[model samples]
Target: MQHAIAILDSGVGGLTVVKEIMRQLPQEKIIYFGDTARSPYGPRPADEVRLFTRQIVDYLAQFAPKMIVIACNTATAVALDDIRRHVGIPVVGVIHPGARAAIKSTRSGMIGVIGTEGTIRSGAYEQALKRISPGLQVFSLACPRLAPFVERGLFGADEAEDVVRSSLEPIMNVPMDCLILGCTHYPFLADAIGQVMGPGVKLISSADETAREVSAILYHKGLLSESADIPLHQFFCSGDPALFKQIAQTWLSEQISITPVIWQVPNIV
Candidate 1:
């Protein structure tokens, strides 16, 4: 049996990373778990987020995955180290990849970060960025409403631009060359965000960077899948299966021609 890469997130936001993984490592099997019932983990307490992450990890352990990716920024902020300690497999988080990407993309040394309350509060990006380049300027904001909006699969709605505009008002004139979509869910609203941020500022999503990291880690460990056959990916969620299926199909249909098998994991919650 193929040892799949296990990815866990607060909701459909992690599909961003999944899309990149499918493109970069086509042969690897994937086992993804989305805790949609507790969708917006942004505002939740750190301890609570840690608990929820642990529960999801414990559940995903059944698959005996070769690696684990914490696709949720908020959970990664509070639980990455804990999850690393809990699991023996290679564990990756969205924060550091995103911070590194932002650092590399910015020419002005002025970086803007937009994420959930928990992520912003933890200052994980700020720390990660400063740890590498101490002189860089970092501006962090908590847009608590955006994640929930994306969770509802309304990113394409007409009002999305307006919502993104309002949420980004504070940092509009910050003079940053690049803005990091610190939360995975933010990428779903990337079009609207780009319009709001305008032509000057480049938008960075950790999805691509995180996917690259996964590929490198697997290669270094000699864990890269050698199978020539197409791998079937499995998706599980703790909430509305219909909504999860709809979002997954809409985002991934272009990359994966075969429809994914999605299961509603009621017991995980």
Candidate 2:
């Protein structure tokens, strides 16, 4: 059987990645999982994030995906290697692609990174950037409340603008010419962030870069879809399936079916 690319995030944020995938790899099948019940993995402990990511990976694995993509910045920062080592399938994450894109976009050698608390605190983007360009100056800020706002589907609201402006005010003073939206969820707020940062700064969305990486990987593995028919796309959420479905349809501009992945509470018989 031809397998699909499995993508997961802490919540609907992963759809950003999925959107790019559908656009870039229109022929490829996709299976996406959103851990919405435990959304906003940013503030959670690294171990907790890792545990949750592993559980989601295990669930996605049953589908026999050709590859797995951890579309969440916090999960990629905290749990990527662990999942890679544990899973039989090839695993991809957002940090390297976002870092590479930022490195390529910046002319001033100074770049800014905005992500969840876990991702920023992990220094994943900074480490990835410096690894590519040793002398580059990297500034990272953790926008803890930003993901929650997006997850709640508050992207265009005045409250979102206020939160985005306040969250980005510190980085606006920096002289960075390129900013990486390190969190997958952040792209939903890109307009508000772009307005606050103005046109001088180039904002790099991890979704776009990641989709490119996925294409490259699939090509190298000789796994690119060969079917002439439109590929199948599936979405699963661990929380509020109705809300997730509603937001996804609006965001992706398509009607979609969403299956809820209920986390069963273990019995203590």
Candidate 3:
């Protein structure tokens, strides 16, 4: 089943997962959808988030993707099942992989998670961690503005350092040995996060783990693409297409065409 893969997020964060997928499965074509118009799905109601995610899955399904990767932890926690059912495709989300990786990397059983308000409030990462190992301690922090700040290209700036440090101070002060970047956009601030977290802690980006799971699922389902010609990936955003494209190239390490859409068919599979 050599076919294109669809990856979705509320904003630019999902591109981190897409980057990993591109590196791991270079032959696969991708169609990435970022609902930037409704960016920061974290604070919205769960049902609304589910509906928004379902809509994107339906839109991407029209492309006949073999799999749909939910690259947003907030969405994964809130809507993975809805999107999967709506699209009827091999759907994957970031939560489980990130949870597993955090558990694996933690020696003190203390795992810290930083994500959007939605993800932190959802407690999906905590549930996943506890479900795997009930004894593991989980700390969650919400960095609501962090995503947009990164999207605005302020992450690498010196001024952003203080915000990053303050935002993560609580988590850093904790005894956690592993920190899960529960939001895709959080990786853009990895350097700042790492500096605040100190060298002893291992930072886990769900993007890498999530991409690995995507590859595994595609391989097992026999949907892995085989084109040696190098597949082309297209990006689309509901808001500023040019800005979205710029952010995509910045994070994914490649430039691609991005178009603006009024809306992608909003429905479940």
Candidate 4:
């Protein structure tokens, strides 16, 4: 096995997970695919999202990865189990790790969650948290506009602050000691979100915990790479390569190459 960890997202959001993985497991090689042309899977129907996710997974499997990470919360909510059952790899998702971190970080037992409408509607984080701590109070808000803004590469822009603040207004009335950025894309808007939520509220990004889970799984499976050389990382997107590459370089702080992959058209036999 090549021992590479493959990751997929609806769009650039998954880079958040990649960032954490690179920081914690610098030796592991990564192959990432983003469905940017049909970005923002959060609003699509479950079946449609599942189909899209499967299509991308089959495409990524060409790399013969040892594991796959479903870095988008909406996709993880709708497609993680289906992909895992058929893919036969150690597949990880952002929901559990994020919920676990939120559960631990909330000292007041009041936690708030913000994510794409599809993710919030799926109740994956709420379910995960309750399964672990039934008594904990959970409040969730669906920010339908956040993901689209992120996909457009508008983080930290002047307009982003107002959009983020408005989307988070619902949760401001709720008393939460911890707030989980339930969607990977939410981290890019954290500054605006933090400004609205104030300093006392702890913001939890699933990236760190999800990375740790990936490390743990690889360690347990004895798939940890022994190569001392700087590992190679490849990125592919189903959208504009230039935009994806620009964001990837800025996010990773390195000049990494991104190859463009188009979704294959099936022959009508």
**Highest-lDDT candidate:** 1
- Ten residues in sequence with the least summed lDDT for candidate 1: 255-264
Cα lDDT tens digits for candidate 3, 1-269: 34688889988888888888878877788888888878878789999998888778767766888888999988999988777667667889999999988877888998888998888898898889999899988888998878878777677689787989878777667888889999998888889888888998899999999998888888898787767765767777777676776676667555333222323423332
Tell me the lDDT of model 1 at 204: 91
**Collision count for each candidate, in order:** 0, 0, 5, 0
TM-score of every prediction relative to native: 0.97, 0.94, 0.92, 0.94
Which runs of model 4 end up more than 4 angstroms from their true locations? 254-269
lDDT of 4 by residue, 1-269 (tens): 34689998998999999988988888888888888888889989999999998988887777899999999999999999999898888999999999998877889999999988899899998899999999999999999999899888889589998998889887787889999999999888888989999998999998778999999999999889988867778778888777887777777775243333434323211
Error of 4 at 23 (Å): 0.6
Query: lDDT of all the models against the reference?
Result: 0.91, 0.88, 0.82, 0.86
lDDT of 1 by residue, 1-269 (tens): 88999998999999999998999999989899889999889989999999999999999988999999999999999999999999898999999998888887888999999999999999999999999999999999999889999999998899999999999999999999999999999889999999999999999997878999899999999999988889889999988899999999888878754557778776654
* lDDT, candidate 1, at 252: 86
Q: Which ten residues in a row have the lowest lDDT in candidate 3?
A: 258-267
RMSD, model 3, all Cα superposed?
3.0
Rate residue 183 of model 4 by lDDT. Answer: 92
Pairs with backbone N, CA or C atoms under 3 Å apart (clashes), candidate 3: 55-266, 55-267, 86-268, 86-269, 87-269
- Where does candidate 1 stray beyond 4 Å? none
Span of ten consecutive residues with least summed lDDT in model 4: 260-269
